[model samples]
Target: MAVALSRRTVAKNALSQLGTFALSGGSKAIAAIMVARTLGPKGMGTFSLSWTLAGTLAFVAVLGLDNRLIRELARTRDPRELERSLPLACLLGLIFGGLLTGIPALTGVHSDAAQALAAAGGFVAVSAPILIFRATFHAREKMEYETVTCVVEGAVALIAVAVALGAGFGVGGAMLGLTAGRVANLILCLVLYRRLWGPVRIEIAARRWLGLIHEGWPLAVSYSLTATFLRFDILVLAIFHPSAEVGMYGAASVILLTAPLVAVSFSSSLYPILAQAEGLDDEHLQSVFQKTSRILIVAALPLATGLTVLATPIAEMLFGSDFGHTGRYLALLAWILPFRFVNHLFGVVLAATHRARSRRLAAVALALIANLALNLMLIPTWGAYGAVAATIATELVIAGLLLAGIRPLRPILARPLVEGALVALAMTGVVLVTPGGIFPQLATGGASFAGGLWVLFLWLPSRGLAAFSATEQESAAAA
Candidate 1:
C-alpha cells in the first residue's frame, strides 16, 4: 500500500512534468520561429549555435552533482547532509560555470553574437544552481514546484523574445530576453527552495561535495555527450551551409525534438522512484521499468507516424513559407522519436541500477563521437537532409547499443514492442487514408493508437482494482 502511494505519486508528477514540457516546447517553438524569421537563416544559425554552446557548457558546470543529490535524497530523508552539500554544488557550479561560460563568449565569437551568447552563458551559470534546488522537489516527487517554475520561465522568455524582436533587436535581442527569463527562473527557484528548507547555510562541505562529484561525473559526462549528440548536427550544418539553410534545419529540428522532450520528462518523473528500488528491490524496478518502456514505445509510434505523415504541412504552417523544406527534414527526422524514446527509457534503467556512470559514459561517448563524425561526413554533401540522416543513423546506433546492453529487458520488451509496432502500423494506415487536414489526420492517428492500447492493456490482475492500478500494485508486490 505504501508502495502504491509512491507509484501514484510518480504518475501524478509525470503528468505535471508533461504539462511543463508542453509549455516549454510551445514557448521554444514560438521563440525559434520568431527569431528565425526575424533574423533570417544566417542570423538564426548564429543564435542557435551560441545557444547550443551555452547548453553544452552548462552541463560541464554541473559535473553531474544534481543526479547524485537527487538519488541520495530519494534514498534517505536526511536534510542536514543534503543541505550542506547542495550549496556546495551551486557554488562550485557558479565558479566553474562563470569562467567557462564567459570566456568563450567574450573571446571566441564576433560582436553581436558574442554579446548575446555571453549573456546567455551567464544565464546558464545562474541556472545551474536551480537544477540542484529543483532536484530536492523531484526527490520528494513534488514536481508541481518545478512545473510552475518552468511555466514562469517559458512565459517570461516568450514575452521577452517577442518584445525584443518587435523592438528590432533581432536574434541577439532575443538571446538577451532568454537570459532575462533564466534570471526569473533562478529567483523563483531560490524563493521556493527557501520556503521548503529555510535559509541556505552552506559551509564549504569539501569532502562531501567532492564525493558527489566523483560519483556523479559519469552522469555529467553522459549528459554532455548526449546533448552534443543532438546539437552537433546544427553546429556542423552551420559550418557547411548558409544561414537560411541553418534556419530551415533549426525549424525542422525544433518540431522533431518536442516528442523526445516528452519522453525525457516522463523518465525524469520516474527517476527518484526507480532510484529508491535500484539494487534493493529489482523486481519492482524491473516491472515499473518495463511498464514505462511500453508506454513510451506505444506513445512514440503514433507520434512518429503522425509527424512523418504531416511534417510538411505542419512545418509550413508553423514556420511560414520562408522555411519551405522544413517538412522534408522533419519527415526524415521523425524516425528519431521512437528510437530516442526507447533509448531514453533504457538510459533511465541503467541509471537506476547504479551502473549508469560507466556504461552510459562509454555508450554516449561513442554516440557523440559518431554523431559528430557523421555530421561532418554527411552535412558537407547532403546539407540539412544529410544532417537529418546523420541524426537518424546516430540514434539508431545508440538505441541498438542500449538494447544490446539491457539483456534483462529483452523478454519484457519483445511483446509490447511488437504490439506497439502493429498498432502504429494500423494507426499509420488510418492516418494515410483519412485525408482532410493536419488536425483530422492527427486526431485519427492518435486516437487509433491510444484506443487500441487501452483495450490491449485494460485487464486487471488480482487486485480487482483498475488494470493500471492493479499492474502497479502487482509490480510493487513482486518487489
Candidate 2:
C-alpha cells in the first residue's frame, strides 16, 4: 500500500506540475505570440535577444544552489538555514542584474534594443528570490504552492504585456510587462512562504553565504555551462545575422523551447523523491529511474513526432503569415524533443545519487565547447539553422554521455521506443489527409495517436509501459 501510495504521490505531483505548466506556460506562449505578431520579425528579434541575455544571466545568478538547497532542505527543513540562503540569493540576483544591464551599453547595440535589455535586468532581480521560494515548497513536497505562484506570474505577465503592446510601448514595454509579472511572482512566493512556513528573517550571514557558494560552485559551473550552451547560440546568431532573421528563429524557439516544460515539470516532481531515496540500493534506484524514463520517453515521442509533422501549420497558426518560414525551423527543432526530454531525468538521477559534479559536468562542459565551436563556424554562414544544428547536436551529446555515465541503469525502453515511432508514423498519416485548419488537423492527429496506443495495448497487453508496471511494486516489496 505504501508503494502504491508513493507512486500515486509522484503521479499527483507530476500532474499538478504539468497542469501548472499548461496554465502558466500557455499564457507565456500566448504572450510570445502577441509580441511576435505586434512587433513583427525585427522587433521580435530584439525581444528574443534581450530575453535570452536576461534569462541566461538570471540562470547564472542561481549559482547552482536551487537543487542543492532542495536536497538540503529535504534533509532538514529548518527555517533558519533558509533565512541565511534567501538574502544571498537576492544579492546574487542584484549583482547579475547589474551585469546584464551593463552588457547592452558596452556592446553598443541599437538604442531600442539596449533599452529593452536594460529593462530585462529588472526581471533578473525580481526573478532570483522566487527560485528560493520554489525550492522551499519543492522540499516539503507541497508543489501546489509553486503552482499557484507560477500561474499568477504567467497571468500577470500576459496581461501586462498585452496592455503595454496595446499602448504601443513596443519592445521596451514588453520587457517592462515581463518584469512586472516576475515582481508579482516574487510577492506571491513570499506570501505563500510566510503563510505556510511563517515569515523568514533576512539576515546577512556572510560566512554561511560563502560556504554555501563554495559548496554549490561546482554545480554552478555545470549549470552555467548548460545554460550558456543552450542559449549562447542566440547571442552568437544575433552577432552574425539580421534581427529579422533572428526573430524568425526566435518565433520557432518560442514553441520549441516551451515544449520542454513538460519534461521539466515531470523531472522536478521526481527529483525530491529521488533525493529522499538516498540510502536505497542501486537496484531499487535503477528501477525507479528506468520507470520514470520510460514514462517521459512515451510522452515525448508523440509530441515530437506530431510537431515535426505539423510544424508549418502550427507556426503559421500561432505566429501568422509573417513567420511562415518559422515552420521549417520548427520542423527540424522538433526532433530534439526526445533527447531533451530524457536528458532532464539524467541530471536528476546524477544529482540525487550525489554525483552532481561527476562525469555529468564533464559531459556538459564538452558539449558547451562543441556548441561554441559549432556556432562560431556555422552561424557565420548558415545563420539560424547553424544554431539549430548546434543545439540539437549538443542535446544528443549530453544525453548519450550522461546515459553512459549512469551505468547498469539503462532507462531506454526498446519496445516502447519502436512502438511509439510506429504509432507516431500512423498519426502523421492521418493528420495529413484529414485537415481543414490547424485545429481540426490537431484534433484528428491526437485522436488517431490515442487510438493507435489503445490498439497496441489491446494486442500486446504485457508490452511497452505495462512491462515495467511491477518496478514500483517490487521496490515497495523490497522496502
Q: Report every candidate's CA lDDT.
A: 0.76, 0.82
lDDT tens digits, residue span 402-467, model 2:
887777568757976987788888888888898587899899998987787677655466565565
TM-score of 2: 0.91
State residue 108's C-alpha deviation in candidate 1, in Å. Answer: 8.3
For each candidate, give its TM-score against the true structure.
Answer: 0.88, 0.91
Per-residue lDDT of 316 in model 1: 75
Best by TM-score: 2
Model 1, 1-479: lDDT tens per residue?
Answer: 02442667877988888877787666766788788777766676777776777666766677777787788877776566556666766676677656645765457755666666666666667767788888787777778888888899898998999999899877668877877777788889888877876776566667676777778888888887888888898888878888778878888888876767778888878787777654523677667777788878877776787788888888877777667788888988888898889888878777766754477678888888888889999999999888988999999989878776665665256766787778878898898899788888878877887777776666323325566687899999999
Q: After superposition, which runs of candidate 2 have C-alpha atoms over 4 Å from their true positions?
A: 1-5, 103-110, 279-281, 450-479
Task: Supply candidate 2's per-residue lDDT for 85.
Answer: 81
List residue ranges in candidate 1 displaced over 4 A.
1-5, 91-110, 411-414, 429-436, 443-450, 457-479
